[model samples]
Target: MNNDSLSAKPHYPILDGLRGVAAIIVVTFHLTEPLGTGHLDILVNHGYLAVDFFFLLSGFVIGYAYDDRWHNMTIGTFFKRRIERLQPMVVLGMVLGAIGFYFTDSTIWPLIHTIPLWKMLLVLLIGCTILPVPLALDIRGWQEMHPLNSVGWSLFFEYIANILYAIGIRKLSKTALGLLVLIAAVALAHLAITSPAGDVSGGWTLNAEQVRVGITRTMYPFFAGLLLSRTAKPTHIKHAFLGCSFLIASVLYMPRIGGTDHVWMNGVYESVCIIIVFPLIVYLGASGVIHTQAERRICKFLGDISYPLYLVHYPLVYFYVAWISNHQGVTLVQAWPSALLILLGGITLAYASLKWYDEPVRKWLRTKLG
Candidate 1:
């Protein structure tokens, strides 16, 4: 088979499983109300780590998919495909949010304060190019954090990295450029919040800005993945050990070293995890670690439904909570079963949507574009 053929040795099925796992983590993380306190919150909110995983995986997958043409891949084809894949869902999400904002009797003020329709339209347009910083600036606050599409910000960065990869750069090596940019980001954070005279602001302002800064800073992990792509080694025992060791040590020692709470720290943790785990995932997928009949069936099913699950689950969770609020005092334990039920229902809807919507659309796009 030609190397560029889509069916030429599918190299990343396990990564699909990884996507399922990440989506599950985000679901679990958001299902609870520990946003303010508890160690569980720390660990659970670590679901944000999945976003980093996604970026790293994105970098790796894009590099793998287009490496043959990395030098000559036309920006037109690159972005055209990205738009086809992304824009439909983004439009759907925006329409949902806009309708919800205007028609729903919840709270119009927050939506209006955070993002008007014009701003959102601009975000949708400019965001198509991977200008996340500008997009981030456009949508501020908890309400506007995800805006019309909660997962849209990361997609924005993924597209940005795609453009950057396609366009190429000059003078500095990609690795050196990535490292310097990472360092500058960290220094900017430190100067912003940290101080020689102690956290004189007592972490109030710092805490407030954490999520936004963290999301943008998450780009470094994607860069790390790009660096890994530039110099990939065949999967090996020693390399896996080193990668795992670095990942564990970084996660463990980072807090002791201070600044683990910084947005940049998330990028560090994500990169380290990718360095450790990605090769293993690639190896397992290639070698068929779960080669058994049942295993393949489950992985394929989960992988197929993963994207839909990611798309549908978020609003459903919050909406479920809203729906159940009037009954009585429902503890997390009580609410969780209903949450799971809702998730399962969402999964069913997702499966149907995949069959009826995503596949047909993808097929039409590929035929038209290819």
Candidate 2:
């Protein structure tokens, strides 16, 4: 690739909008989770796969942005850039989670009152660093590393992927990277099919098993995404944005394929979606263009709020989940208004944080550190 090609980076507006769409679906998934028994019956059945999709998107974007620029970038410089781009929202998400911590008190976590203020503050501090907390220190009873902001676990893995890329993976030849992706894909399939729950969903805690799940989830799609970036040839496609968005939604909203009796069936389905379908969707999104001014504005708005929406929305979800748990018999029909409020509230907070806080922090970081 020439320097000009490297410098004039193409913005995948549709990909950004797709990311925002996935974030919205995730919030809907969490909102509806309390009404279901398990993954099989959840309202948005495959929303958790959004995290995997995110890993893929991150890898592709990173490769596209940095792989060729390595000659001008040191590992330290790359890490700094990644931190500047990502860490601000992470901190903001944790703070929001802390501010709303007490309000989430409910029957599920009866000990919320028993935990002292100092401990909560300490967890918040640790959470800001994106470090995993042990089970002994799990303050929220969910056993999440960042109990206040459960999504931090994914960010933790994101950092890990970045570190790996900086240290060595970025230097690998295409053949070597392809081999690595294949190995990781096999591991992912095994983890998905063999798990007792028949789904690959155990990466929030600090344990051997969960760590395995986390690693398996992170490795395959990320590397596949890296490979896709290296090999993908974008073609002109009409309405690619709409087409790709529909594809993503369809995959995420599909019902469990095999039901409870054949858990591996759903596992295989999830594996195929992550390993094959998501990459195709990303390719389609990246290849497409926003033809009209309205489309461009829509994509821009969604792209702008995508990260903030993903990071900052979950704290409110904790309260929503707690509220639903407290009211046992309330159907989603009765709770639609509150759910709409939470959705709008999350979008509003995310937009405000983007304009007022996150963008300013990032600009300062870029001025000082760039």
Q: Best candidate per TM-score, number?
A: 2
TM-score of each: 0.68, 0.97
lDDT of 1 by residue, 272-320 (tens): 4444554445443333344456655665676677666666565555455
Clashes of each: 0, 0
Q: Against the true structure, whose lDDT is highest?
A: 2
Predicted structure 2: clash tally: 0
Off by over 4 Å in 2: 1-7
Candidate 2 lDDT over residue span 1-370, tens digit each: 0000133887788888888888888888878888887777888888899999989998888888889888888999988888888999999999999999998999888878888999999999999999998888799898888899998899898889889989999999999999999999999999999888788876888999898899899999888988999999988777988998899999988887788789999899989999999999999988897899999888878878889998999999888889988998778898778888999999999999999998899889989997
- Candidate 1: stretches off by over 4 Å: 1-5, 33-43, 98-146, 169-216, 236-288, 321-329
TM-score, prediction 1:
0.68
lDDT score for candidate 2 against the true structure: 0.87
